[model samples]
Target chain A: MTTIIVIYGLLAVCLVASLIKSRQKTKKAFLVAGKALLKMGPSLLAIIGIVGLTLGILTPETIEKLVGAEAGFIATVVAAVIGAITLIPSLIAFPLAGSLMRSGATVMTMSVFITTLVMVGVVTAPMEIKALGKKFTLLRNGLGLVAAFAIAGIMGVLL
Target chain B: MIKTLKKFAIIIILSLVFIAMAIWLPDIAKRSSIVAWDYFKEMIIIMPPVFILMGLMEAWVPKDKIQKWLGNRSGIKGMAISFALGTLPTGPLYVAFPMASSLLKSGARVSNMIIFLGSWAALKIPQLIVEIKFLGIEFTSLRFILTIIALVLVGKLMEFLLRRKPDKEYVLPGEGN
Candidate 1:
């Protein structure tokens, strides 16, 4: 844990130094999203709403007890299905998986959950559509869901 | 006042839904809370640094450079590089998106950007260590291989879609008007 902290700290320092050195050369538009994120806040909120709903519906205990040793495989399926309708940050997903593991959840479960959490985002559909346009967002996320499940399944098989 | 009211209305609707779920499917609410908190804690520790890293990337990397490296003109080679770059150690998906949006605006192909963002979230190195520790090396290796394939495939699919009829309204990060 200490080592992790130290490594992260060094990373932070490096990033900051890089930022400082390049501050003058960097475009303000790039750094601040040219203040458009605020306008996009509502879309972001909607995405959050979807994520919360999915998280609320799926429980780690339910996944663990039900899936057991095959938890990883089961998790991939559940995550892919859920991910098809949800959107959440990876930071939140990882720890959620960690917590689940602490309580006897399988790697397959965590792996699937994390991958889906990132890749498959149904909740963000509207916002994604609005931003990147409909076809692009849907195709990307759809592919992502398939990938999440495949990855989980393959991991289960090989690992 | 109207905006505030709208916000409040949204919150109320959400709360009512939660209340309904709690009342009817009480187990769901209870279980979700139990799961959410466990994940939430580690997130608290890791997220700040991740956010900072993202901010730094935003603050440092030039959009043009990103474009030059992985723009639409860069083709398949650009896609491969984007995939590898996206696999770099990083944080959650949300934090990465803003940076990605910036890249897109600077001429980075949407396909490559999407691939990078997707892979960034799915294929983290440090998180992989944690996964290995908990799940064993075999599982970790499998997950990695699967995720990589998925990310690449997804990227290709996204490219195909973009080619069909790309949207002009996508407001890139720096070019948000």
Candidate 2:
């Protein structure tokens, strides 16, 4: 859409400017932004806005229809449990969740799915273990999975 | 210069693949329309502040402080602090990894660092606000409790495993590849 294009365009410009400023050494500029951006306030603000949009778009009715009542509840927990061991980038998870939502997936299911998608990351296990050591990675992810499920279940009950 | 070339090549390839998918898969375009727009907009708005924060962290937080906080000998207190700190609102997982890596290099226990990074993704403050707005307070509170417990347990488990036989081959940041 127009919004997407504009945003990407702006990002491209910023990236290009940064690259040029660093004397065409793309990595230097990109890395600087990449590292510096981690602590930047705008990034947090944008995250807030995105979270708002996601919440606004997701309706409770959408939750009931996608997963069904009983099955949906079960699915929520299952997804969380499974998510702990699986890992994929947010780019994939967001689209997949959106597609599912459009196709009539429940909000609860989507919530659980999204939570697990980032939190559990079983797929990234080997890489994480390698980088941080095996035992620590496993334990952290394991805890994340449980938290994802708990969050989903509690949300389901409250909302 | 070589790194620049490699980066350029990677970027070009990635862009091409993206374009190819966009053209070849019409469904992707249709499906991702609203969500993608929303995500893009969100990213643009938030990126500046996030980058600023990253700069601040780089400028202010010293390597020694991170080490002392999560050092190997710190025990349970260290893990608890790491988890608490990780729960703070932050950026994507990728952003947290480098900081965690730095901690690892500075004498932080691998288990504690892992817990910190894991919590960074799972228990972010901004994410919590979103959950509260959409889901309600009770739900968010319970989730937080559960996530904290899980992170702590995992951290302990990792410690036990590492002690059995530490892997010296694993690369910590700044150790060089």
Candidate 3:
């Protein structure tokens, strides 16, 4: 994919530049990268497992089924809750949301679903807590939940 | 060793859950493993360079530079920079967490950091194209506009709440991250 190519290209260029400018500093950067990667290994594994479970069970077809079956405010709330918790890759999620829209899920529900899906990360909270600290993790995600609802409500009303 | 053991606790728990799922719900378990394997490939592929970039940043970029660019007084400029940096074709949300931690240690403001993390999670340019493709221009554009506005609000709100208390100094993960 383009993402892979661009990142590797950039990395290659940067690595060459860093090595040319200061081999020792470049070595230290690799050291730091290794340390950080090691520190994160366990949590990363945990997150991948959670993502797998989420996707395995809550496939796009299943999401469409669940969101489409409900209607009104309750449906929006349900959608928001699901979105807040699940970390579906946007590649899979948008098409799923689009299809749900075509099938009769309300605009409010779809918008909230997509918004919360991006903003909130209940499943990844442990990794977040590890990286950002408990309070920062709590406040960012908690406030994000509020903002997601507000965006969804306003979008619901407008479009 | 205790700290390392503590770190693995959640992984162990999740692995146990996976095992339980495998026993009771073999189909879902198989599906989950497949999904996990797929993501694992993606993560290893895209994550190294990302961490290298962060490592390079941590080693090369000075704290004053980060602070001046993304610190509180930098205001709208700082916010804009944070959002722009985040919208880069980075791997995923988790990849941003370590960099955000580094930026915080390097003295980036909470508000800008919030915006950075939020946009990284939600609003990558490539992801937006995908969104527009599937969801339509109207839907994509509107969501984009709204997400920006909401992120700005979220940034300000988090800054107000977290910074007001003073003791909430985000401890960098083991010093300057």
Candidate 4:
């Protein structure tokens, strides 16, 4: 993907620049990277495993069906909760959301699903904690869940 | 040793659970492993350069510079910079985690990080195009505006709470490193 290419290019440039400027600093950078990667290994494995399980259990069809089958406030909540749980790629999610909306899903339902889908990550919480600490993970996701609903409500009223 | 296992307890348990699932339900296991493998490949391919970048950032970008650029006093400029950097070619929210962590350790503001991660997740350029194509211009635009506002509010609130509570354990014993 373009993202990968850009990152590699950036890395190459930065690495070369760092190397030219100071081999000692560059070595320190790699050491820091190695330490961080080693630190993250377990949590990373945990996240991948969790992602696998979640994707397996909740296929795209299942999400589409579940979101499409419901409506109104309750449907919105279900959609939001499901959205918080799953890590669907954006391409797949947006189209599904659009169709669900066209099929009579409320503006609230789709908006909440979209908001929480991007903001909250229940499945990724463990890894998040490993990286950003416990309070941060809790506060960010907790506030994110609250804000997702708020945004969804306002959007529902306005649009 | 025990502490390390404790650190990895959830993952260990989950892996065991996954193995059991594999034994009892081969089909689901196969499907899940394929999905996991894809993610693993993505992670492996994407991670080295990212961590290296983070390392370079940590090593080179001085603490005061981070503070001046993204710290509390940096104001709207900080927010703009964080959001801009975040919406770049980064792959996922998870990838942003370590970067954000390093930023925090280097003295970046919590509020800016919230903005950074928020925009990265919800408001990237490529993502916006997909959103516009699939969800319509109106829907996408409205969500974009709303998300930006919400991000600022969330960021401010988090910065306040996190700053207010210095006594609280912010990071795990060895995890902050």
Among these predicted structures, which one has the highest lDDT? 4
RMSD vs true structure, all candidates: 6.2, 9.8, 2.7, 2.9
For candidate 1, the lDDT comes to: 0.60
- Which scores better on lDDT, 2 or 3? 3
DockQ list for all candidates: 0.29, 0.15, 0.71, 0.75
Chain A TM-score across all models, in listed order = 0.58, 0.48, 0.94, 0.96
lDDT: the better of candidates 2 and 4: 4
Give the TM-score of chain B in candidate 2. Answer: 0.64
User: Candidate 4: which docking quality band?
Assistant: medium
Give lDDT tens digits, candidate 1, residues B1-177. Answer: 988767455446766776787899887766555545544465556545544454455566676777678875677888788778777664445545555655676678766777687767666676667666655676667767766666666666766666665656753332212
Q: Kindly list the per-residue Cα lDDT of model 4 for residues B57-127, writing each as its tens digit.
A: 98999988988898868898999999999889679888999999899888788889999999999999999
The residue ranges of model 3 lying beyond 4 angstroms of the native Cα positions read B1-3, B166-169, B172-177
Candidate 3 lDDT tens digits, A1-159? 777888899889989989899989899999989888887778888889888988889877777778895668888888988898898888888888888888889888988898889889998888887778888888888888888888878877878
DockQ of candidate 1 compared with the true complex: 0.29
Per-model chain B TM-scores are 0.64, 0.64, 0.88, 0.90
Task: Give the C-alpha miss distance for residue A124 in model 4, angstroms.
Answer: 1.9
Number of the predicted model whose TM-score against the real structure is largest: 4
Residue lDDT tens for model 1, A33-148: 43545544555555444456567675444444443444444445664565455554444445556666666655556666767776766665655554455666777777776666
Which candidate do you rate higher for lDDT, 1 or 4?
4
Clashing pairs in 3: none
- Which regions of candidate 4 are displaced past 4 Å? B171-177
lDDT of 3 by residue, B1-177 (tens): 998778788788888989999999999999999999998999889888888988888888887888889875788999999999889986678988988988888888887888899899889998999999988898788888888988888778876766655334564321222
